[model samples]
Target: MRDARPAALGVRPAALGVATATTILLAGCSAPVQLPDPPVDDATRALCTALVADAPATLLGSPRRATTGSLAVAWGDPPITLACGLPQPAGLTPTSQCLEVNGVGWWSQDGVTGTVFTTVGRAAYVQVGVPNSYGNTGDALAELASVVADHDTLLRPCVG
Candidate 1:
């Protein structure tokens, strides 16, 4: 009875093993993460395409997941999604602060899914949707920032 209690509270050892195996299998055979393609001009599309292509294959130790299109991508189980060539963040203002991650500027907002970060002070707006399961999004942002810095034009310094 006591053993059963532990299993109910957490999970049975056998069940845990099965779940782990299933996770591994699902990782390899994952459906593409679907994100809305933003409406942007040809020049913005070109910029975003370069940034998306330049993004690393891995983020926060998780391999990039299959995503729907060039405008957006995702990674890991919970799926950290990145989208480029977006409109300016609605919450942002002239006085808003931009946090620098690996020299790229990002402005953040707490959303239902997690923390949503939009790139500031650049030629194109880039958004990263990070689920709370990933904990600190900084690690994930740093890698993506490198891609942005490489591919996008810097218009103004990231305002701290």
Candidate 2:
């Protein structure tokens, strides 16, 4: 008997095989990055929205990617993720020393996975997490410094 499997399925044999292969290949691909959406007050949200809108289209040579949260933005594979309107970090005490970049104050704390730098003494809190693979946070922070300073109100200046 002649093969009628493709005809019964209403598709050509070659097309059916191609479609199956495409699906299998796509299944192995990863999804877009999803940033956490932390709770923020109304004023903070407004500031974050403005900052996000004015944020750079590219960072650290990587084109910006669409992130899941409104108050967050990311760039590149192994993304450098930025989240705004975060609560004050416990480590940010009166004595905490921070890096001053483009007039923006950032507190840097390194972890096993990566280094997380959060803006200190701003009206609205902003956090940027740079993975270890990215080498260092300097370039990333410098790129973002002006944008963060322009949008987020500086409550207290950071020291170098």
Candidate 3:
């Protein structure tokens, strides 16, 4: 014996409320938040050279370095080469273990100086000095990892 008039007229407040709530919920879940790109610095040139030298023979020469503020990046393949700069080999303090990622050597300074080294290939390595070195180590390493991973992809395409 329930009334069918409201359903027929399409005036159900509960249905409208549900629709409005769903719309608002979807709006909140729309898109992912993105982090801003790190800045590039003038010293990135040196960093690129060191990294690219390590590229596999197939990569010839392809590392490019760019720096902004305290962050430095080295990228490229084979002969192209890239680097932020080379840190002074003798002056590094409390040197940490060198991490081997995909056969490439990556090192970091564990102090406030925030210096880092990355091997791009067999005979190439690059150094970088970052600002606020203490807090930025993770960011610096992540950036290097991204470049290294990309190089691997270029040299060895994913089959799956």
| Rank list by TM-score | 1, 2, 3
lDDT for position 57 in model 3: 34
Worst 10-residue stretch by lDDT in candidate 1? 1-10
Model 2 lDDT at residue 109? 71
* Cα lDDT tens digits for candidate 2, 30-143: 334455467788888899999998889998898887666798887765667788887776657766888888788888776544677888888987888776778867999999
Better of 1 and 3 by TM-score: 1
| lDDT score at residue 45, model 3, on the 0-100 scale | 36
Q: If both were scored by lDDT, which would come out higher, candidate 2 or candidate 3?
A: 2
lDDT head-to-head 1 vs 3, winner? 1
Residue pair clashes in candidate 1: none
Q: After superposition, how far is residue 127 of candidate 3 from its true place, in Å?
A: 2.0
Q: Total clashing residue pairs per candidate?
A: 0, 0, 34
- The count of residue-pair clashes in candidate 2 stands at 0
- Give me the runs in candidate 1 sitting further than 4 Å from their true place: 1-29
Candidate 3 deviant stretches above 4 angstroms: 1-88, 91-96, 100-104, 110-112, 120-122, 133-136, 149-160
lDDT of 3 at 124: 23
